[model samples]
Structure formats: C-alpha cells, structure tokens
Target: MTAVPTISSPAHLSSPDGKTAMTHTPLRIGLIGAGGISHSHLRHLLTLGADVYVYSEAGAAELVALYGGTVVDSLDELLAAVDFVDVATPTFTHHALVKRALEAGKHVISEKPLARTDAEVDELAGLADELGLMLFPAHVVRFFPEYVLLKEAVASGRLGDLAVLRFSRSGAFPTRTPWFADRALSGGIIMDQMIHDIDIARWVAGPVERVSAVSSHAGDATTPVEAAHVLLTHSSGAISHIAGIWGPSHLPFTTEYSVTGTEGSLAHSSVAERNYISHLASTDAPSGLLPEVDPAENPYFAELREFTDAFGGGAAPRVSAAEGAEAVRLANAALLSLETGQPVDIESPSAQATGK
Candidate 1:
C-alpha cells in the first residue's frame, strides 16, 4: 500500500466566501515514475483517500488532471512535502530512490526486488532497522483473495501434506514504458514477472531448496529476457513447476494454480474469463466455489491498510524486507540454473556458484 496523504478537495467548488467544507488528513505522497503500474497505485491511493502528490519526468499534468492533485517537479520538493513516498520507478533505480527517501526520514513502500543484489537489499534492510522506520515491499499477490485462501488452506492442513504445486501464468505483451524491455533496468521477465509466482511458491510450499529453469528473450529484443519455465524443490519435500510467457491474446491475462496433497487436490484458475476455485475430495467427487468479484474494490487496499497498521503499531510488515530479499535470491538462482544447465542452490551466497 502507498503511504500517501488524503486530500479533501472542495477548492474549485467552494463558496465565494473563500471557505471550503471538507476534511482530509492531507498525506503528502511523493510518487516516482508514472507508468502503468503507477496508475494502479495512483487509483488505489486516491480510493484510499491519500493526498496525492505525483512525481514523474512527464505525465504529471495528465495524472493531476485525472486525480485532482499537484505534481512536484523535483525530488527535493517531494521529499520536503510528503509524509511518505512511493517508488514505482524502473527496477534498477528502486534501491537508490528508496535509500534516499529513508535517509530523508520518510516511510517508504517500494515496488519490488528491493535491489538487484542481496548485498544492496541487506544494506537497505539494515538502514531501515536502524532508523526505526517502515519499509515494505510490494508483493500484491499475497493480498489476492485466492492466494489468501490457498495459504490458509495449506496452513490449516486442509490439503494435507503437499505433494506437488504448479503455476501457469501468461498474457499478451503489456504496452509498457521503454524501460521495461531493458534488461539492465528490469532484470528481464524472470524477475519482473515470474518472481511473483516464485514468491508464491515459497510462501505456500515452504522454503525452496533448489531451482532449475530455462529462459528466452522477447523475440529479438536486446533488453529484458521475456519468457521462462522454472522448476522448484521445497524443503518440505514438495516439487513445483512454474511457467510464464508473453504470447497470449483474446485474454488480458491468465493464471492457474494447482496444489496436490496426500488428502486432496485444490485447483484455482483465472482463465476462461472466470475465476474458479475447486477441490477434489477424492478421485470420484469434486466441490468448488465461485466468489463474487466486486467492481472497483480489490485486495490492494487491504494490503495498504495492513502496511499502515504495522507502521502505526510498531510491528513488522506482513511481507518483510527479508522476504523480498529472498524472492530476489530465488530469482537469481533460477536465472543461474537456466544459464548453467544445473540445479541452483537457493542458499548459495556467491553469485558465481549459484550461476554455475
């Protein structure tokens, strides 16, 4: 969740007496990068009633026009004005922006892969700890209801001991900003896209022991590698496979999750233009659920609410900095495995060894 202030704006429609009747906490929010993902952040921030102060190289006017707020021209201005900051910039720049914001004594909600390297992640984690401030990584899938249900089901032994888990995610290429295709900026699709599933694999199955994978670039693009298939082995004796690609059409995006266990198997999918959750009690009978999807409401708000709650209560974030680091670790290992034709150890400290 973005830590933006609420703006109760009645200024344009106020009485001629120069008085406006509205109330707002006025969270000074400094948002970096106005990209596609940033729009979701902006919308959710507005919905959450935050004082939206946008910061982007361009598109400031458009954002302000739509969201009814001002856009600060300089990062310094943003730092001085905002209570907290949200970094939605290119992946390579996230660490520097977050580091600067935290150094300025402001709370931060960073977009992902806290840094390209574990060393950088460790540095940021240590700094946040020293400042006694909040630094939460954006792992929005954890907030999705389906994911929540799956986690609960697994934890409660409803699915028995896990035997296998498989995830399939694909979609058409996003009309993204140019930075997205640059491998240096985005770390390719493995980190940019499939990392979400990698995190999910660990979250539901337990710590991953090793990973093996294969990858390819987006056609002839020189930037971020675009597609991947990864295999994961968990410490709990669970074997999992994940596939991500960017060639689907006729559907905006699709995801399928299947977990097989000693007692039963549960499958959930956001394909066929429907989201379904089903369970096979035995080889013979099956039961399923279809939860209603409400328009204009989502788990992202809840994710933000949880972040603020943790900050206010002096508790750890639901998804800690360490977890984000580990996600990056897994991504790095998978890339290593893909390049070297071998299983990469998740706990390996040296990049050379992991990539071997």
Candidate 2:
C-alpha cells in the first residue's frame, strides 16, 4: 500500500484588504487519456495554472504536442509524477484507472458515471475513504449557471416542494469513437448521455425509489436513432420524467428542463428565444432569466476549479465518490427497467450491504 501523504494547506498571502492572495504553488496534475473530451480538460487545467502531465495509450505524443504537456509512456509514470490525476478516458476505463490512482494515494477527478456498476462505485468510494483521499466525479452539469440557479430556487423554499421534474437532452449520435455505440462498453444512450439529467434529478428531487423506462433501442442494436423515456419516482414522493434522444448524425445538441413545484415552476429550453424562464406563484407572469457570465466561459473550468480548491483545502469535494456511484446505480436501474419493461427498485448502499 502506498503511504498516504498528509495534505497541508496551500500557502497564501494576505492582502491589505484582508483577502487572501493567490501565492500558493500551482498543483501538479496528471491527465490520463487524451481524446475528444481531454481537450476540454486540458484547456481548463491550463487556465488554472496547473503543471499538467499527460499520458494516453494511443496518442500520447500527439496530445502532448498539441496541448503542451510532458509525455509519459505509461499510467504508472504519470501517476508517479503528479499530485492529482484528471481522468478523461472512455467510460469503460474509468473503474480500473480510478482504482489504481486511489490505491496509489493520489487525489482523482474522473469524468461522470464514475463506474459502470453500483458495486464498483461502492468499492472505489470505500477505498478512497479508507485512504483519506478525495475522489471527485466530473458532473459538469451541476456547475452550469442555469442549473445552479434552478437548484438554488428549489432548495430555498421559493418553489415550495417539488412535484414533477422533466428533462430532455438531445444531440447527434457521437460516432467519434467505436466504443460509444457498444452498449456493453458505454452503456448506450441512457448511461452515457442521460446520466447528466439523472444526476440532476437526484440532486433536486432527492433519492430515487424506483425507475421505469421505455427505450427505442429495444431489439435492434444498430439503430442510429436512440431514445429513452425514463420515469423516476423519488423517495420524497416527487416524480421525474427524463427524455434522452440521440437523433440522427446531423442533429444539433439541445437540452430543456422544467421543474414543477407546489408553489411555482422553473423551466429552460434551448429552442426558445429566451433559454431560461421561471414562474413563482407569488408572481403573476413568467420571468425570463439569464445568468451573467462571460461568453467564453466554460463550465468545465469551474468544475476543475472546485476540485482543485477542495483538494488544496483538504475538504470534501462537492460531488463525492458515493454520489457519483449512486448516479451510475440510477442509470443502471433505468437501463434495467428499459430492458425488462418493469419498474426497477433502487436500493441504497446500506440496504444492499444489509441484504435488505
């Protein structure tokens, strides 16, 4: 077992205004797997002033040349060189890479759907806890300004109690990689694409009690157009209808959501003239809302900033390993429900351990 290093607070200088200054040494980060998504990670990591090292099995040299990182030949070499590891690998590689990094006592920020199965997620979470390391899953949607505002509105009692939540995320099929089409590897549209809305539903509506789903990719595996309608029954008695669509290859990316509560409702539509809108029972008409942000800002940068801040301060990450695991569990349940045409019950980690 690798000896876990104690995380000391980063050095900071105090300004005359009593605000802390950015005097801390930049975090040395290792990025694994350079693919389409890795560019986003690299851009964000660079913006944060981190010393980045990259390793990819297929194109380490090319990625390093393009992204300006020291090329390492293997995962072990990269792990040995950095304090934190940002995993931008494919869905199938997440479990093993995370496990190795955690065991090596390195803090990790992995892309969403932390693992394919609930059990795998549990094991990794347990290991990280035992080792006193941080494992943050990159659920970037949570960091989106509109989503953040929506969550705040629901949590502030402004919306009273949530009743029904509807979400739709549609895009052209991601045929960039061959593994994306493989259900066994990527978990198809539900696990790969819809997990974002699934996590959002869990964040706003509380734990999901049961899930029932209908999918278009029932029998024919080669279908180019894949769609799933998932119904989630939350423990708080709130219900959610999540629709995921991978239209044709030429379709544009779009997302829309509506959260209805006893008091009011908040909604967003990519196709609408105004993207975000909210209605409160206390008010008469719907109000158009737009988050004040730089047009060039990327939510992925915000997500990485959160991880680095938490890691430096030795505090808990916003999205814990356990939460990431549950997201995967929920996605799996939805897929299972889709296949069996029956409602799938979601068991908590404790319930599973107790065999309840």
Candidate 3:
C-alpha cells in the first residue's frame, strides 16, 4: 500500500493576486473498517469531495480498488495522515477506535450506538471536549427525507405536542458476519437494530423518563429469529412504542413509523417506497442489516458532508456526540427492562452532568 502525504501547515495560502483568499482542500479522511455499512459511506465520501485513505486489515485493498481511494497498510499510519477519522467498524471496537482517533487530535465520525455503555460514551465526549475536537455519531436516519419532514412537522408546532410515537423495524438476521447474533458484540437486536427509532423518539417527542420491554425468540441455533417491543414514557408525557425483529432470512428489510400528536399524525412505510427506493444490486443484499436506499440521494452522504463541513468550522451537525450517548443510554435501559420484565427510569443527561 502507498502512503498518502498529509497537508498540515499554515492554515491559509495566498492566491495569485497576493490577496488572502480562502481555498478549500479536499480532506484526507481515514475510513476504518471495510465491512457492510462502510461501502455506503465510502461511495458518498468520494462523491462529496474527499481524499479517502482506508485502513482495513481484511478488505482494505479490495474496497479501495472498487471505491477509488488510497489504501493504507496500518491504523497508526492512516491516523497520522488523515485530517478526520470515520469509524465504520464493528460495535465492539467503536469505543477504543474513536478514543484513539480523538486522542490523535483528529475529528471523528462514528456509526450509531456510539459505545456499548453510557459511561464509555460520556468518556469519549469528555475526551473530545478537552482536546478541542469534533466527535459526531453517524445517526443517518435524521437526514432521511421522510424522517426530516416528520421532524419538521413536529418542530413547526403543527403536531401540537406529540402524544404517541410507534415505530417498527424488521429485517433478516445478518448471518454473513455471525456477529449480529452475539449480544456481547452487537448489543442484541434492540441496540443494534432499534436504536434508530429510539433516537427518533427522543429527537421528535422529548427525553424519556421510563422504559418497559418484552421479547420473544424462536428458530435454529444459528440465525434464530427474535422480536422485542419497548415502551418508553417521555418527559413531556408522551408514550413511544418501539418494536424490532431479526427474522428468518426470507424477510425483506422493512421499517414503518406512526407518530400521533394532539392535532394530527404522520406515518410512513418502506413497503410504499418499493418503487422509489433502490435496493442493493449485490448478492449480499438479503443478508445485510440495513435496507439499501438510493445511493444518489443517500442520507449517509448528507450526514458525512455535514460532519466534514463542521470539521472545516461550520455549525454543528444535527446529531451530536452527547445525543449519541443518550441513544445508547436508552438502548441500555431498554435491554435492562427486557431482562427484568419491569420498567426502568432514566435520568436526563443534563441532570447527570450536573450531578443531580
């Protein structure tokens, strides 16, 4: 693998006329992990004007060959050369990789479920803050067109105080990697698959005060199907019911949401988007945890572009490091409820930070 040079000197350069005109440099971004969700971000990074330097022990060369990026041989070398780090690795490695990147004085963008625990998420955020670096969690659902519209409707007060939010996401178990079934690694179905709606419930309604959940599972030892339902009581007195399923391989990836407020309601279903959305053309489509949408109009691109702009001194992106931590807290609480068969109370992040 060829090493790409890093550009890190005098923040500005002089134009031909000797005037201090600001010019943009294509960011040297180090993308870690070349697995499933990685390809989505890589394709968009190249289109969004980035000099991507990928570091993957398994599939770095193959991914770069297909995606048009410089392949790096090691994580240390890649970190030394890139301006920002994009973590697309497995859930188990997110904490360590993100902390390492932030400590190296580079901004970071990590995939959802920032870390396995609330304490880890808090530590990462505090580390980035003390180091004066940006840490963004790639919660790409917020950038989706329909979800954005739903958020807009709620924010505009047309929804007149959300009362109930219902969401369901179901897809086949990702047997390809064999990690998805391992709760210790993937955080089970709730943290892995349902966190999207978990984040949305807070993003639209408000912070949650309590959570209760129940689950059921059946099938063969490998690729067994499981489903769970979680009920969240929000601080604003709204109720959110979230359901998730990792079904048998025949199940098509599907998601649906219905949000109702005092005034009206909004709903959407992936089934309706069959004609509009574009499923992956690859053979591994059925085995993927996520449903492939149109790459040209991908939300992944929007979130990554926003993070890059923020790295260049722009406003913070829609999702923040702290919010990412909160999502993890919610999932953690839900998992506890699933195990104990009881409702769990959650403290607000601000309250926790203030030692309340």
Candidate 4:
C-alpha cells in the first residue's frame, strides 16, 4: 500500500494586466478504473498542475499510495469531489460509469469506443449533447508525433491520393484480468484491438465505405469472437486491410500501420512504439542517431491535458465523442461482416448515423 499524496495550491502568477493573480488552483479530477492504463493516467496526472482523486474497485489503494492522492470509497463521493472524471475501465463497463459521471454534472473523458454497441454510443452522445458537457474519448494516438507526421505526409500530398492501407496489431490475451477472455466483455479482437486501426483508417483516409472480415478461435474458446482479419474500403477510394491476432509471441502487442500512395509511402511498426521509442532516432541523415533525452513524450498525457484544459475552459475536444462512436460503428460493422461472412457497407443506415 503506497501513500497517496495531498493536493497543494501553487504560487500565484500574474497576467500581463496587473489584476490580482489567479491562484494556481489545480483542476480537481476523479479517476475511474485502476488497471494497467489507469496507472499511466495516475502517474501523468501527478505531473500536471492539477489536484487529483481516484475511485476503483481494487487498485485505488495502490494508486492513492503512489500519487499521494485521496481515494474515495464510492463513485458518488468521487463524482461530487471532482470537476471532471476519466473512465479507464474495461470496454463493457465504460458506458455506465461515464453516464453516471455525466448525470452528476461532471465533465467526462472515457477510454475509446464510447460503448460496446452503436446504440450505446448514440445514447451517450445524445445525453452529452443534452447536458452541454464535454465528453471526450481517449483516442490518444491522434496526439502521437508519428500519427501527426503520417497524417501530414498524406495530407501534404507527399503520399498522393492514398491508394491502400494495411494495419495490424497483435498480442497474446492480456493477463491483466481474466475478463479479457469473455467476448461479451471484451468485444473480441475486432472491437478491442483492430478498432485502433479502424479509427486510424477512417481518420487518415476518410469514411469507411465497406467492411469484410474472417476470424478463428483457439480450442475451448467456445466464442465466435476471436482473432480476425478484416478488409475495409473508404469512400475516398482507399482500400485498407487489417490483421489482428491474439496469442503468445516474442514481439507481441505490436501495431503496424502503412499507407501506400501514388507518390510514396511510410510505415510505422507500432503506433505505441513510434510514439514512445521512434522519436529518439533521426531519419534526417543516414545512420540516424538517438538523443540523450527522448525529447518526445507519451501522447496520452497531452491528450488528457487537452481534455482537462477544455473542460476547465476551452473549445471542442480533439477526439470528440462522436468520432469515438464512429470508430465503434466501424468495429460493429466488422463484427457484422464476420458473422455473415460477407462485406458490409459502411454507408448503411445503421452506420450512417455516426456522421462519418
């Protein structure tokens, strides 16, 4: 059991106009879910100029001890205490937790896919709109330099009208918790894993026009949801192929995204890797060198900062809740395709509500 730190106010700083200094009052934040990713969020929150609190079924003690923050025993207490809440729980439980926070009048940021189903996403979106509260999804990749670089590469015409994209992410089943094996809970590789690619494809390219998929199961898995390979076509005429597998591997839990165009191509082995490790290397000159300091940091921190800043007082979110819903809609389409063994058009009415 680590000791949670206490929140302290910062020294006042004056603006250009000599009015009374605005006290560095940290934005009070309540965190949900205490899993692998939650720790990352907890650690980074400590670095921010904000106050922090946490609520989780199991890891709250550990998190509080590590961050020197208070761990409330109930969601109600957590909600009342914070100006905003972040939900890092498993995919299945995201909706309920986020809904509660929103209903409490606290701003929210949830880990991607808004919910397990399109209807859930639609419901959340409507509720957030009605409440006029910020509902951001942690599509942290958008803040990655590699994604920024890749997106700019395509947008700059360095990669001519993108012709094709092939993305893959694979790893053994996560051992963090046993719930990962339950398809109803995990939403399979397509929902849980390939969605990053699905969102990336839609983001870097354009609207997904259609989706088709095939999957396989290991012995005794007893679930139709398992490893899968999917193909996607975009309205911009770009074709995307994705392969996602779950099993043991030496270099497992890797992500690979590559885009080919009339002019050129750039491939990133893994979005997470590229964000964390690739920045140290230089491609400007041959025999690229790594700096003493990585210079670049995890994009997740920046993503959360933006959400908080906006929730504190700013414009719209970078990864809006609607885009999160759109990504899940594509994942749902892939699931539909897997079941029917045929291609599903993204233009279908069910998918169209996502606003592309």
Candidate 5:
C-alpha cells in the first residue's frame, strides 16, 4: 500500500489587503512563449479558472486562438497586467525573462533547468529574494502522482532504509528547435533532459556529495548528443544511476524508477501493461520522462495548480528557487565531470563548473 499524504493546497486566496484569503480572487496569469510546453500550461491554467494573458514573439496569437487566452502585444504589457508569469520559453531565455517578471513584482513559474548557468540562477534567486517574490521551477515530475507516492513512501520508511535507486528518462530528441542540440543553450542532455531525473534523484535520495558522468556526445557544445548516463552519490550513502537519452523520432517517451530499501522495494513504469502494488516488478517496458498522462491527471496541471495557489499568496511550492539553482549546480557538476574525466565534488563548491 502507498502512503497517501495530503500536501495539496488549501482554500487560501490572495486578498485585496495583501493577505491570504479563503475567498477566491481572479488571478491574471501571464504566459510567455507559445511553444508546445506552453500549450500544456495554458490548458492547465484554464482548468484552474485563471484569466490568462499570453505574450510571445511568434505563435502567441495562434496558441491563444486554439486555446483560450488573450494575447498581449509586448512582454512589458504582459508583465504589467498579470499577477505572475509562466515562462515556457527556450532554455537560454529563462533567466532574463524570469528576472524581468520578478522585477515587475510578478511571481514566476519557469520551465526546467531554470537557467543555463550557475551565475544566471544566482542572479535570479537574489533578485526574487530582494523583491520578496516566489520563483518556482516547474519540475513537474514532483507533481506526478506516482512520484509523489514514492516520495511519501520513502519519507514514511515503508521501504525501510533506502539502499539503492534507479531512474531512467528518455524522449524523442527535440529536433523541432535547434536550441535543443546546442549545449550552450540547452545544456545538452544533462541540463535539459537529464535534469529531470537529477532533481528527482536529489528529492528521493537526498543531497548529493559528488557526481560523475559519461556521454555519447563527441566534439563541442553545438554537437548533437544522443545519450548520457550519470551517477549520483547521495549524502546518505545511497547510489543512483540516472540515464537520459534523446532517441529517434519514432522513439516513444518513457519513464520508470525503482527504489529499494532494507525491507522492501517499489517501482513503476509508464510503459507497463500492468503494475503491481507490493514490490518492484516489471515485464519489459519502454521508459523515460514525460510519460503518458491521462488528460485529467496531467502532472503539468497539478504542478501549475500548486504554483498558482502559491502565487495567490498561498503556501510555498514543493520546488523552490534555491532548489532550482541546486539542480543547475548539480547538472553543471556532471557536465564538469564529463569535461575533466573525474568525479566532481559538490560538498565544497560554490556552484561553479567548467561546462554548460
């Protein structure tokens, strides 16, 4: 059986007096970037009954037409009008856009990686702190019910002392956008794709002391890399093997995780025909990040709702801006390990790394 803890939001809302209120007030949400990921967020925001405002260089009008939202003419207009901004733009643009939104006194929910570099993340974090605003990285996997259950189980000691864990995430290599291949922009596979598992690893296995990685990528930052594997040595002595791949266009997206402890184990696979509840078991499944989610149970929806409540002066969300910085730091550490061919020590570091 799973330990089902209720971490969902309360009925709290933002009051005109600038305090938490139980009465729901209309929240004006500004969505920047009309990419595919933005579509997911827009749908969820609508489901949450938010008044949506969208802005983008391209596709904003089209997206608003297909979905429901009023397209804004400029980023400044969107910033000025909304309570918060959801940044679903390309990897390289997150920091600047998030900073601009924060400076505008709007809270932020940024897509993953948060930013490309540690310095960028630090600047955003500091700005948010100075402004006394919240910046959440939409690490949606944390909102996935399966993952939430696993995390609760771990915390409950149902599986006893965690001994080892394995996580795998894969998806079709994002070729629609050239930025996905540019290591400087996307941080290659580690920061863009693998960072999902990296964040989860830290969440479940606790803080990491060090990291080592190997990649199939050869040549420079712009070179297209297909796959990479990372090893995380957690502070509590548990080890995790995380694999990320950008496979063929025909490759089905999949994700699976196995957590083992002294007393028992639990596992789940997206491609499974059927899954048991008791122990870790599977019968040959296709796996990676962004698994098939029922429309009603979309993790993206759950994630955004939580952030939306927090934006409404509710409780803080699960993934904080500092933790977002840490994810970038750890991903950079793995990238550094690839560069130097040695394990990178994070125990005594200032989030500096030699790679993207």
Candidate 6:
C-alpha cells in the first residue's frame, strides 16, 4: 500500500477564526465531458469554488448554459486553460484524454475503469510519474459513507478475520448512449458496474488469488439486460461472491452486501427497512445503527474534495492509479473466467518472475 502524505495546512488558506479561508484563488478545472455524471461533478466543483471550463464533443452549449462555465471548442484549448482536467468521457476515450492531459502538465481526475487494458493504465501511470502530475481515478465507492464505515470496521478488527464477503449491485440498463452496450467500449457489465465491488473486495479482503464467473450476456450480443455472478478467492483465504445486474430501463438502482468474519458479521441492503445491521461476538464492539451520513453530502463531492486536498498538499490520492489498474485487471480476469468457464488464476509478481 502507498503511504498517504500528511495534508499540510497551507498558510495562505488559513483564517483567524480557525475556519478554512475561502479567499484563495479557486483552482481552474476543465471538465472533459458533459453527460449524466458530469452534472454531479459540475455541481460539486461549483460547491468547491472551482473555476470551471467545459469541453465536450456534444452538448457543450447546453452544459455551459446550465452550469455557467466557459465552453472550449477543442481539447487542447481546455487543457491549456486549466490546472486540472476531469475526464468524464466514455470508457474508450479515457486513455487518450488522460495521456494528452498528463503530457500537457495538467493533473487528472478520471472516472473509473481507468482504461480498457492493464497496459494502457500502466502507460498512463508511467507518463503521470514522468511528468510529475497526479493521475487520480474516481473510484467513488471508496468515498461512500457505508463502505468507509465497513472498511473501518474491518481494519479495527472488530469483525475479526474476514472469511466471506457477498456483494450485489444492480441497476437499470444504461440506454442513453449506444456505446455502453458495446463490449469493446464499455467492457460489458463486469467492467462497467461490477468493478466497484471488485475494488471494494480487494480493498477489504486483500489480493485476489483466483476468479470464477458466469454471465448471462457473455455470448449474447442482442441481450439488453446484462447480469453476472462471480466468485473471488482472496489470497488471505477470504471468499467473495459478487452479483451484478443491469435490469430493464424502469428498474431502480440497488446495492447490498454482507461481510462475515470469525467474530461477527456486518450487512447492508438498500431495499431493506433497516439498511445496515451488525452482529459481533465481543460485547465491546458497537452494534445496531452505524453513524448516519449527512443526507446533503454527496460521495462525488467528497471524492473531489479529497482530490483537491491531495493536489494542494502534494499527497497521494485516496485511490491511486495503481489501485485503479488492479481493479481493471480483476474485472478483466472475471470476464476471462466468464468466457472460459474455468477458474482463472491471478499471477502475482513473484510467480511471474519465476515463470510459475
């Protein structure tokens, strides 16, 4: 794990009343895409007091009208005008945009599944390092309050050694764009949606050793609703069962998980009356309702806030590029397993060096 640098309190940003000073010049940020998700980012950026510029192949005018940002005609113009670029474009465009931004000496905050392949991600990471720029992937699940609390529980050993993890994420199929249904562009449901649970599982349970998966849309190109079930065997002997569904357009988004450890269990369900529940063998451990999240707080806002904080402090992002790459790697492995109908072994570095 990369060590996170301490966040320095910049003198110019401090105030006499001990509150954060808002007088500092706002960071200029260029948003690369203006889609459904871009609106959320735009709102958050405005709340963060960022000077926003937008560039999009389509809907630039509408976005500018709605969000009140300068519209740039080209990527170069946007890159030259901002200190950072937020790439919210389609999955296929990530590599080129990120590479260009890094080459332009602008820091990047890209939406997840950083790139289509591991090699592309590695290349981007290398270029970011060479250029001394930050490449932060927006794995927004890490910023979700419930997931953060679950991570804390596991890290504090309140649940003891984790043995089993079951996670599910289901939502209406994305029909706004045709590319999302294309496997070449969106990487299907595994890479597009299941990658969230993939990252969370790896984060809490450690490295994955093997992956076995089966999907409904594996061989069917005409299928609109995609669904999959995957089993991951972690290096630490913990197993995770993950399920993903892209139901019909009218269905609502829902996610749930249950983590079982030697001492107790923690579970959550979006559809349940009580969203979070916990049972611990030790009397000292907290049970029942977890800390309530501020209803006004948006996870995307929290993610961008952390990114800006890290950018100012010259610290590592909450989610590193390497970690994002690993999530993509796991997603690919799951897809491979789905195709082959066999368990795929994840080759560790030592094993690869020895040609095991």
Clash totals for all models, in order?
6, 0, 0, 9, 5, 0
Model 5 lDDT tens row, 1-356: 12222222235767889998774456788999998888899987877878889999999999989889999999988988888789999999998899888888988999998999989998998899899988999888888888899888888889998889999887766776888887888898999888988988888768788899998853343333388989998877899899987765445677889999998999988768643232223323343224688666677777887788776657777888888888899999999999999999887433322111
lDDT of 3 by residue, 5-59 (tens): 2322225778899989765577789999999888988887887678899998899
lDDT of 2: 0.79
RMSD after CA superposition, every candidate:
9.0, 9.0, 5.2, 7.6, 6.8, 8.8
Compose the digit string of candidate 6's lDDT tens values, residues 106-163.
8899998899887898899878888888888899888887888888889899999999
Q: Give the runs in model 6 whose Cα sits over 4 Å from its true position.
A: 1-23, 218-223, 274-294, 349-356
Kindly report the root-mean-square deviation of model 3 from the true structure over all alpha carbons: 5.2
Clashing pairs in 5: 170-288, 254-287, 254-288, 255-287, 255-288
Number of the top lDDT candidate:
3
List TM-score per model, in order: 0.80, 0.85, 0.90, 0.82, 0.85, 0.85
- What does the lDDT read for residue 162 in candidate 2? 93
Which numbered prediction scores highest in TM-score against the true structure?
A: 3
Candidate 5 ranges with C-alpha deviation above 4 Å: 1-24, 217-225, 274-290, 348-356
Q: State each model's CA lDDT, in order.
A: 0.72, 0.79, 0.83, 0.75, 0.81, 0.80
Candidate 1: how many backbone clashes? 6
Better of 1 and 2 by lDDT: 2
Cα deviation of 124, candidate 3, in Å: 0.5
Q: Predict model 4's lDDT versus the native.
A: 0.75
Estimate, for each residue in 1-356, the C-alpha lDDT of model 4 and write its tens digit.
Answer: 12323333345687789765766577788989888788778877776656678899898998778766778999988988988888999999988988898899888889876899888888898899899988988887677776778888877899999999998776555544667766678777888777877887787887777889988886444322247888988877889999987653222345668899999999887444345333234333221110111225657667776777686565566677878988888899898987888899866533443322
Error of 6 at 324 (Å): 0.4
